[model samples]
Structure formats: structure tokens, C-alpha cells
Target: MAVIEYQHSAEDITPAQLNGFFVGWPNPPTPDVHLRLLRNSDAVMLAVDTETRQVVGFITAITDGVLAAYIPFLEVLPAYQHQGIGQTLVRRMLERLQDLYMIDLLCDTDIQSFYEPLGMYRAVGMCARNFARQSGQ
Candidate 1:
């Protein structure tokens, strides 16, 4: 297994390194927009391939800095899946948000098992999505 370096800041990252994510979305955000979101996020964790300097996985959270936080995204490139990258990103992000009173995320049932081991539990929640705005324009 190749060594994957994790980073808490996107200071040195470029949109070019953020390829191969948001795999199945009907309208995924472009790498430029993706980088923008990462910059705008309250917290972000990235898993990078030391050799390629490519972002293989990432997780992001938005917090009010006091009572709550919402993790809006967590994804690992298909090629890097099952190598524990996602787990590491989540674990690190959780630790980063440990002071929050409530940390929450919405995931499909299929991936719920993945988050379970990291101390997250299933919950009934509601959400609204504007497909046209899915690309984060």
C-alpha cells in the first residue's frame, strides 16, 4: 500500500489535484468549485497520495463553532476505496470537531455501516436538495 498523507489545510492544494471525486452525481461540482467549497468550509480533511500529490479522499464539515456541526460531504476516489482512507478522514474530522455539542451527517443507508465504526449512529433526519444547484454554482 502506498503511503497516504493527510492534510488539515488546503493552502497548498490546487483544483488540478482534486480530480476523480463526486463520482456518481448527476451534476457534480467542478474541481474549481470543489476547491472553493473546501476553502469556505469550517473544517476539511484531505487524504493525499504522497507520490502524486493528488487528493484521494476528503471530508468537510460546517460548524457554528459552538453547539453544532454538519458534515456535508465525505468521499474517496473509487480507486482508493476500501484502503481505509475514508475511515481515516472521518476519524480525523471527528477529532477536529470534538468540541461541538452535536456533529451530524446524512449518508445513504448503504454507507451507514462505514461510519458506524467511527462512533456515528443512524438517525432520522430531513433534508432538501435543489438538483439544479447540486453543482454548487
Candidate 2:
């Protein structure tokens, strides 16, 4: 197993290092857009492979700093999935937002079990997406 490093900032990150995410999205963001997304997010946690200097996984949060936080993305590269990176990312992000009154994320039913062990509970929520802008162009 490669040495994995977790970081909370994207300061020196580049587009090339962000390849291979958003696995099944029809219009995944390009690397540059991904970089922008990371920078724009209120908080981000990244799992990087120290040996290859590649970002293998990431979770992004949008927070109001006091009351609520919404996790919009949590993804691991296909090759890196099932390696505990995703769980670690979520845990770290949650810790960072622990002071908030609410921390929320929406995921499919199939993945809800993956989060239950991490202290997240199932909740009803609604979302609206504009697929045309999914790439964050």
C-alpha cells in the first residue's frame, strides 16, 4: 500500500494531480474546474498518495461557520476505493465542522450504510441539480 497523506488545503495543488475522479458522472468537472472547486469550497480534505503525488480522494464542504454545513462531494479514485481513504476523508471533514449545529450530506440509499458507522444518520432532504453545469464550467 502506498503511503497516504491527508491535507486540508489545496494551496499548491495543480490540475494534473486531480485526475480520475467523478467516476460515473456524465459531465464530470475537468481537472482545472476541480481545482477551482477545491479552492472555492469552505473546507476540503484530500487523501494523497505521497509516493506518486496524486490526489486519490477528496471531500468538500460548504459551511456557514456557525450553524450548518453541507458536504457536497466525497469521492475516491476508482483504484483507491475500498482502502479506507473515503472513510477517513469523511471523518476528517466532519471533525472540522463539528462546531456547527448541523452537518449534512446527501447520498444514495446504497451508500448510507457506509456512513452510519461514522456517526452520520439518515435524514430526509431535497436537492436540485442543473446537469448542464455539472462540469462547473
Candidate 3:
């Protein structure tokens, strides 16, 4: 594991530094689109590899700023998946949102266990996806 720096803001970040993410998606966002979303997000936490100077993991949240917050994305590069980067990003994001009354995210059942130990609980929710626009056009 190389030196990892966690950042809350997208300052100094560029599309070149964002690659190898959105793994396994058929129509994943390009690095440029990724950077745009990061910049637009209400809150963002990034895990960067100091040596490579690349973003290896990131989490984003959308919030009403008073009480409700929703985590829309959390991803780590495939090579960095098991290195605790994802966990650290989530923990930091949660801390940043501690003042909110609700912090929610929707993840697959298999991945629920991962978030559970980090203080998340099971919940019923509904979501809709438009794969045609998944690449963030």
C-alpha cells in the first residue's frame, strides 16, 4: 500500500488524476465526467495515492443541508479494493455529515455487511436507474 491521502475538497484535482474507477460498469463515466461529478457533488471525499498522484477511491453525497443526506457513490479502484481505502472514505464522509439527521445509501445486499460494521443498518428503499444515461451525459 502506497501513501494514501484523504481529501474533502476537489481542489487541484484534474481529469488526468481520475482513472481506473467505475470498474465493471458497461458505460462507466470517463475521467472528465468523473471529475465534473466530483466537482458538482455537495460533498466529496477522495482517497489518493500519494506516490502515483491518482485518485484511487471516492465517495459522494447529496444533501438538503439541514437534515437529509444521501450517499450516491462510493468506489475504489479494482486494484485498491481491499486496502481499507473505501472504508476510510466512508468513515470520513459520515463524520462530515454527522450533523445531519439522516444519512442514507443504497447498496447491494452482498455489500451491506461491509457497511454494517461501519455503523450502517439494514433499511428498505427503492431506486430507479437509467442505464442509457449512466455515463453521465
How well does candidate 2 score on lDDT at residue 5?
A: 99
For model 1, give the RMSD to the true fold: 0.7
lDDT of 3 at 15: 92
In model 3, the worst 10-residue window by lDDT is 76-85
For residues 1-137, what per-residue lDDT tens digits would candidate 2 score against the true structure?
77899999998999999999988899999999999999999999999999999999999999989899999999999888898999999999989998899999999999999999999999988999999898888
Worst 10 residues of 2 by lDDT: 75-84
Q: How much is 99 displaced in model 3, in angstroms?
A: 0.3
Strongest candidate by TM-score:
2
Model 2 pairs whose backbones collide = none
If candidate 3 were superposed on the true structure by all CA atoms, what would the RMSD be? 0.8
lDDT of 3 at 65: 100
Each model's lDDT comes to 0.94, 0.94, 0.93
lDDT of 3 by residue, 1-99 (tens): 688999998878999999888878999999989999999999999999999999999999999999999999999988888989999999999999999
Tens digit of per-residue lDDT, candidate 1, span 1-137: 87899999888899999998899898999999999999999999999999999999999999999999999999999999889999999999999999989999988899889989999999988999889899989
